[model samples]
Target: MELEALHQVQGVQGSSYPIYLGEGLLDDALPNMIVERGYTNIAIATNETLEPLYGKPLVKRLREYDSYMIVLPDDEKYSGLNTVHIIFNQLLLRNADRSTVIVALGGRVIIELVSFVGATYMYGVDVINCPTTPLAMVDTSIGGKGAIDLPQGRNLIGTFKDPIAVFADLQSLETLPVSEMRNGLAGIVKTALVGDPDLIDMLTPDDQSRLAYRPERLRTIIERAMAVKVPIVEADHTGLGERLHLNLGYTFAFALEKATGYKLPHGEALAVGLVAAVRLSHRMGLCDAALVQRTEQVLQSLNPSNAPVSYAIPQGRAIDVWEAMRHDPKWRQGKARFVLLQGPGQPIIHDDVPQELVLEVIESLADGVYPRPRSWRMVL
Candidate 1:
């Protein structure tokens, strides 16, 4: 049964790879990927957490080729320089060379690890991103921003190497924790807020004034978000130009993640970041207060606290996440750059964002200065 729901994203950016989005695509996508890429030898880079679930199936499918599976420890905390070294060691031991295709078969952590290795390995090798999580599919796995976390900051060591292909199997999302699913939505929200007015409309309901998460609805949202991202990446494959627009939502997202010591998932921090951007936009007179409030309403509806797991992150953690942002290399010159919304589909990268304003917006959310929708209002 071929799932016709898949959306094919033609590479407007770096290498002109294809993004396959749909259910039950793995069966067809994996083998075709190997043959199409001319990868006679392949390595599946995964983590202990995901190896048990999909690794064997993938291995069996690609068994005809000289394939090896590399599994790393499966926790976000373990994603670091040491992890990168382990991947390199395995690749070297396997005699993986330029012809070897590194298949990142897990979430953001695994993708970052493999992509980093691919970028630096023998001056670069082929990388195929097989993102299993919604977070990976909608955000991390799409763009070529690869990095591992450091004690001082998250993604401190990384590179901009676009993947040869990104195969996002939505069926894999079934295995993801609810927290991770919600976290992935944060990226979609950021994509919308930065640009993609159509996505913003889809995310915000007219009658309810809140965000809604229907599977079909989300698929379209993810597609729209990718549309916004692909063009920017195409214009500046190395992130030297319009690509900075994508980072507008990311700056706050990364800072919040670091501030919380990564206790918060990437998507949760992104939700906070989107709200921060909206508030910042309002303060800068780029957008209206109503727009900010409406945006908050949509986000509050999708907050992870409303999920079955109800991840209770502390206010102190959120503050710490903000503090960590201060040390980010991008902010090294004592000034932070932010992507603030000028209007729907209009995102302006501002290098002059006041530190005070950024701090105030984070504090407001942490302190409940702004009213959170009842659905998301909870004492952490």
Candidate 2:
């Protein structure tokens, strides 16, 4: 299969690198890319679940070269200082120097921890990302924002280190569970909602289910979604300005994940949070009711159950979620800021969102009072 490459300008000064996506990308393209970049030693950091599936095959390909592997737990509970330390220890044991290249292979958890490790080890080192899941392929792996969760909330500890190159091996996605597939779709949906409205047409309830089984369509969807993210990262690599527009639905999304002990996947939580954001946007008169309806309609299409309601907050937990949101990484001066949409593809960062209205929207979602798409009850 032919590999497609796109260059993304990263960091404050706009350093550039290519993002390669397609099946069989690791066969020769990845190794050649690594050597051309002048990396000497190679280290593969991945989760145990993915080690055998992907990490091993990659290690085999680079067997003639000096390489090491560090496998971490796939669970969020294991994503923290300890994991980073373990990876660093491995690098130290292997005598990995500044020229050592860290290859982050796996889903979001592995990507976050490995990226952070690569950034912190020897202050910084080059990293090549082979994002195995759709979520990483489209969003996280491309943006250069590496983070680890703490007791306070998700992504509490993080750093920015652009990958030397991002190799998205689409074949790796063949084994992804349906839940993970849906999780990745959440990123694509958010991309369309906030930036590329035309991409929304691909996510209709009627056609979305087919995407999980169709590789060609999935590739097109990912490429279109990344088109929305690449320019934003190029313009605001540090995420101090325009890039915050991509925070749409993240406040509520993280709070929900915390409340559920991460029982809900990140993308699913974001889908529910998207509905809440749309509801609040309507309440604030930032968008018409039709927009909220349409947004929820697309989200509900992701899963079999009626969203936001299917993943309802437990009784008396609405206030808990609100409290958690106050501690969001983006909150400023005790105010919970949100990326509110003015309309499809028009997003504005607003910290003035009224707390009472926010609480009202959460309470309504808890009570299942917010209007949802009519076809939500039918399972695809």
Candidate 3:
């Protein structure tokens, strides 16, 4: 993974933060990077899935720093107020203060949980994130939209607080199962279409499975995906403007998650949503049908994790998905705001997608499924 690069996420009033992209930075460079910055204490927070595999070893490596560990619940269902209270209790007990830098050392859920924790902890402490998963490294870790799920829906309670820095260590991906890799690819594929359309050329049909284990190509993909997000973030810190383009297929993605009672993994669900978005574009005459055909071809190639779940959202529940779309944070005024593709790189933000057409597009995504590659283990 030689695609090491330094990206600056511009902040308000001309301020900015650095995102260090490389392999082995988490357990190698991160400790000294924190200490050298004059931070006196550190709070490394991760989920149960990552604590033993990555977090504990990292804490031992950084034993010299005034740092303690906080292990969060692994399941998304636990990412609510109760989880927040638990984190607060742990921080209070360990004397985590304003000087303490909360290093979010896991995938999106834990990263966002700890981000919100860092944002509100002692009226906001600095957060330096380590995104272990692919989806997180490129998407969640960049934008400061630290969010937590509420019983009513996902990401209901959130804050727009950027991390002091982001360290995306490619080495951490070695332990992840194929499904986890595909989860990140969903975001990567989206980034290519929305930001750098040329990146899609790399995901040739035969290269999709190999890209997961192939270090050089995978690193380049992650780096390019991150590159696509930075400029939009700098321009719109709050997700009211072009940043919404980042949510290309999330309208249907979030709805499926809600419709399924949040059982479907986000990335897998998003693959299906991307298909829905492109199909909607064709149905509305915004783009040619070839675009939808090409989308399915690409998403199908990135199998197992991202091969749009073999789901035909039961019409009874499809209506539930439609309702979920209405309450979606991205929903504009009284209509659904869909970021549909006019072509590969040309995304159009349409805020007036009618309810009937949205359902038709959602239904058409269930044509067929391609058999996914063998997974070494279950997704975290």
Candidate 4:
């Protein structure tokens, strides 16, 4: 057995499972746990890029059983109902049964896809997670909010399917590209500002550099981020109330992603979104300008995988961005809701914020730079 420590997540109807965090869990601990529990059937669903990296090795370890690997397309654009059908076909063809465990073996898209399948296939089979990216480890994989994007809107189709267990192997993050690391770090920053305020300081350059190879610092960040989400998720299994706090910057972030035609990495869009959220918060007099100043400063300091992180939503597209927001699930009857920050660890959901005011704040961020708090970070 490896040194991975396990934390349990409570699900709806008293269902719960352990999330294991450490190195060597995939190749060593997973097979051992399966054998100890007398599991004879297993399936791993991952993307094409990750199959060679983590999937194949685990399949080899579990080769003696009815273990199979289903590799889908690699990017976010490929995730949809079509991808879900692809997994279903493979599971059906292989005769995976009620007790079969489906392992979601990649990042956000793969986690959502495989977990959804595991929930619906054969009226539910056991599923577990092996989240590879920092975004997945800290945010996506921890919560059982499963969904795939629809042409109508992002995360339009989905379920709340908790996995039987989760293994977030720090070793897997070694090869995470500079581009993806930005998304992961951005997720962490958002999580910090909303729930775990102490974590904001640890997201510095040195820690990010250490995160490149050192598992200890990586584990700390992952745990702290999860600490913020787990209890809220337990309290609000359905995201109708407190859980909404966790999405502090996402209302504007989703708009930015759509305005750019989904080309912006989620982390980049989130960084810009945090800036926008605080700006809106200031506009509403919810917080002082100092909070906004500090939000951008922390985000700018993050340089993951050794690349400077600076990207913005398209300028002169506030209308396009507004339409995107209207399409979000949070928008109701032409009145939008925003998760505003009164301060770090002090997030409030502000509803019916005037559409014109929302547009004003968003337009101000076009081309990426907001009015300077004199040392504000994001460049327009």
Candidate 5:
């Protein structure tokens, strides 16, 4: 029921907006935000999977306004230049002018695509994010950073654009699959491991289903995770400093996703990447060995079945993955800058990581060695 506003920059009109987090708030809150923002026309950007769940209800509620829906492909692999073109064509078909507001409904993939469309359509338009998944509700929805995956790497193309408002309805998450919920926890774990140690406790549950069974506890976890991101975004909107810490496990995660041809969902791959990152940090003497063990244990607690896939990457093919990291968006100058942890809540950026060590970790990850969790037995 409480509305929080991000800090506004001078001369920036749409940089600051309200974020609402609660259950069953969609019918009243989203419409009121649109009317107050003075948008007479609206376009809902979503995907096939989520259109029936969140998008249709929104359409019913917003019948007072001129509105149409652009349903995109639900797969994350489809988050590319082609998808953006489809959205643009829809905007044109619906005759959505600059005055129109874009309502982004669904998980992170849909949110990212909608944010990009709102950012590039006729220069810019208002975006209202209604995140149905935990990842979007906690991390992606709050930040204005919108990106699409390229053949080279994930989120290679992106823009910094804030939404006019963000509506996170916890009720919407009830319809989500359990696998998708586990995937979202990867981002929450990344947030906690880097900034808020209390969030680490939230994810320490041994049973993954408990998180879904306890909605109040789940809400607490989300709020705690967002507390870590909201301020960092407020301080460094363009990711010049502080915000770079959020790259925590993304370097290896993106590489893994690219290697698997993106069959792995973003969050699951991120969990694997977090394990590799901690091991790398320990090998680099940045973090103690205990930190590495604890981080892996926490991750395994969430998804005990996560393990390295031998078939996902060929033997000695980590070199290929290392090459993929070079093309990551986080690469600076000619080197890849990685967010390494010194300890819980202590993250440092390191770009001078030795090539041999990088290859060792990547190779081990491929061989199911370095990131081997306690439950590892090579299922595949």
Candidate 6:
């Protein structure tokens, strides 16, 4: 098993790992990744959603090696300490040792769960992320931020542990729901807003129209998003510096998730978050209103009918979402932080964001205070 191509990611922690993003790379890549990383024993962690789809093939490819799999229920709601405990128990039952590498073979939940297990097992173990979803590929899978949700908030319990390798198979995305696929695009938008404004331009109607049904366009979008995120990851894999910029769209995305009770996918939450950030940026005079309008236009074009309902969450559900954002771990001192746009490819992290403005935005969205443009018709 040998890879035809590889892109090496230099981590801020002074270590580097290869990210293989090509067809059939898994056949050669998986075995070699484990071997080169000095991990002899392996534990494949996946969910019911993806285990039958790709887990079996992955296991078959690695059949020569000593490996076992821990399959959990499929859903973001189960991404918590309880699931982590199940993974831990499985590893313990398998007698997985320090030499064992945990391979995550699903979306963000699986990746986070596997990383958490690896981070905690006998102190730490190696993690390899094979993200099936676009969100995991471009955002959650690579950064080494392993976490599980707590009763208090999202990602409340976890650690910072980089994976030994990350394999993003475009083929895996074919089975992903359209909504989930759109959810992944939110990270692309975030990466663009934070850095690589050119990529933002690439997400035009023409480009999206061409790629709407084409797999290549999706791959291109995912690749571009990954490229935009790499330098940030390299600069602050621990997310202590420039990497914080990545959180600009993320903060609002998290809030949207909390606001919606996690009903919205991460990407959908991100789309709403990006809009809120842009609106806030416009309100603060940080950027022109045109930019916000243009952003909304693009998002509307993406999937207008479903323009992320949390943005306009009904009055009945408004408080629930607001409370979620208020208690979100991503916020500091009970104040929500935001990633506001200065322009394309230039997102700024603002910690002193006003809650009143956020509330206003939520209310306006719910009440259709902002009129839906003609583009909404085009998008639908």
Query: Per-prediction TM-score, please?
Result: 0.84, 0.92, 0.92, 0.91, 0.90, 0.89
1-380 per-residue lDDT for model 1 (tens digits): 43343434344342466787876667777777687767877889998878878887888888888888998887888788888888888989999999899989988788888888888988888898988876677667766778878888778888877787788776776676655666566666677766666575665445442343455665676677777777666667656567767766677777766666676666566676777787888888898788787677767655534321122336545456456777665564777767788876678877767767776676666543222233431111
TM-score of 4: 0.91
Error of 1 at 20 (Å): 1.8
| lDDT digits (tens) for residues 1-380 of candidate 4 | 25445678899898888888888788887778777777788888988889999889889988889889999988888778998888999999998899788889999889988877877999998888889998898878876878887765577777888888888888898877655676787888889888878788877654323433456767888888888888888889878899888888888887777777887767677888888898899999999998887777777666422322334446566778888887777666778888999888899988898878887887766553321122212110
Which residues of candidate 5, in runs, are more than 4 Å off?
Answer: 1-15, 206-212, 304-312, 366-380
Q: Is candidate 4 or candidate 6 better by lDDT?
A: 4
| Candidate 4 off by > 4 Å | 1-4, 206-213, 304-316, 367-380
Report the C-alpha lDDT of model 6 over 57-99, residue by residue, as the tens digit: 8788777787778888888889888888888888889888887
- Please report how far candidate 3 places residue 70 from its true position, in Å: 0.5
Location of the lowest summed lDDT over 10 successive residues in candidate 1: 371-380
lDDT of 3 by residue, 11-73 (tens): 767777889988779776788678778876778899888989888888888787777788977
Model 2 weakest lDDT span, ten residues long: 371-380
Pairs that collide, model 2: none
In candidate 1, stretches whose alpha carbon ends up further than 4 angstroms from where it belongs are 1-14, 36-38, 204-215, 304-323, 368-380
- lDDT (tens digit, per residue) of candidate 2 on 273-332: 888888999999899998898887787656555444335667777888888787786778
Tens-place lDDT per residue, model 5, 1-380, is 53454333221344467777888767787877777777777888888888887788888887888877888887787789998998898888888888989899888888888888888989998888899888898888877888887888888888989887788888987777655676677788898998897678767764535543567887888878778888888878878799899988899988887877777667667887888898899989888999887887777666545543332367778887788788876778887678899999999988868888888787666544324233321100
The reply for model 3, stretches above 4 Å from the true place, is: 1-5, 207-212, 304-310, 368-380
lDDT of each: 0.71, 0.79, 0.80, 0.79, 0.78, 0.73
Model 2 misplacement above 4 A: 1-4, 205-212, 305-310, 367-380
Which candidate number has the best TM-score?
A: 3
TM-score rank order: 3, 2, 4, 5, 6, 1
Q: Which window of ten consecutive residues has the lowest lDDT sum in model 4?
A: 371-380
The parts of candidate 6 lying over 4 Å away from their true place are 1-6, 35-38, 207-211, 304-310, 316-320, 367-380
